[model samples]
Target: MTSKPAIGIFLSIALAASALWFWQTQTVRPAPAVSFKTIKGNSLELASLKGRPVIVSFWATDCPGCIEEIPHLISLHQQYKSSGLAIIAVSMYYDPPNHVLAIADSKQLPYEVALDPSGTLAQAFGNVQLTPTTFLIDKSGHIILQKVGVFELSDMQQRIEQL
Candidate 1:
């Protein structure tokens, strides 16, 4: 008769093997271009944002993570703008234009924020459910990173530095 220990070992080995297989097959991915109108009431082009690293940060007014990271994003903008880092703060829910302006001002966020007036663009890009999701597009406009939730300021800077 087999002992329970043998079964446990077999299960553990199987789990490990499957986990490894899954890890090798799947990873974070970038998105193809999706369209949206600009808050300025003009045609904002996604193509224009290519050939550099663009951070499309998805947020809603009520998300604490969204609110907390504005300052970090502001720093990222200031630090990396001249170095080809483009940050587009995309709102997942519509707030009044004036309110957005005020929050941006208070946070000292000088980056370009295109309001997703209906939050549809968030779905169009990727991961519609996650607030404060940051998509990092590489020099060729292919997505290289999609970070859900708040991330360290230094980590963002480090990645940009490498780029």
Candidate 2:
């Protein structure tokens, strides 16, 4: 049988290992390179936005959460454009181009809207499989935050303010 002190030390080591693993998973890394055409037929490359903070949001028209987040994104774009914040909304492969275009037009989205029909863009961004998966990239083109699902507007604002 193990002594009491030995058991306690083992447990502490295991706990420390688990915490290290979790922290590594949560830490943001470099944003992947991606090039795609926007709804307006303009060529947009991730590298082009290197000098500005960019929010690359993967969304689809049929996703309620994605739809709900658009207004907040638009507001962010308006408030931060002058400060060099660029927002790029990328529609998923399953979403039809026409549907994406229609929604973009209706919403009057004030940022670049692109379609990832081949799933290349999604794969580049860590195989993003869920709608509303968003990445906040810093001016140096490194990902600072990767959030799945709806993100709180106030929290996002605070993060941007720091960048």
Number of colliding residue pairs in each model:
0, 0
- Supply candidate 1's per-residue lDDT for 135: 74
* Candidate 1 lDDT tens digits, 1-163: 4779899999999999887555423324555566645555556666777778888888777789999898889888888899888888887665676777677667767777778776678767754677888877778776766677896788778877867
Off by over 4 Å in 1: 1-30, 94-98
lDDT of 1: 0.74
Candidate 2 is scored at a TM of 0.84
lDDT of candidate 2 over 39-154, digit per residue (tens)? 99999888988989999999999999999999999999999999999999999999999999999999999999998889999999988998899888988988988888888899
Where in model 2 is the C-alpha error above 4 Å?
A: 1-25
TM-score of each candidate?
A: 0.75, 0.84
**Which 10 successive residues of model 1 have the least lDDT summed?**
21-30
TM match of model 1 to true structure: 0.75
> What do the candidate models score in CA lDDT, each in turn?
0.74, 0.89
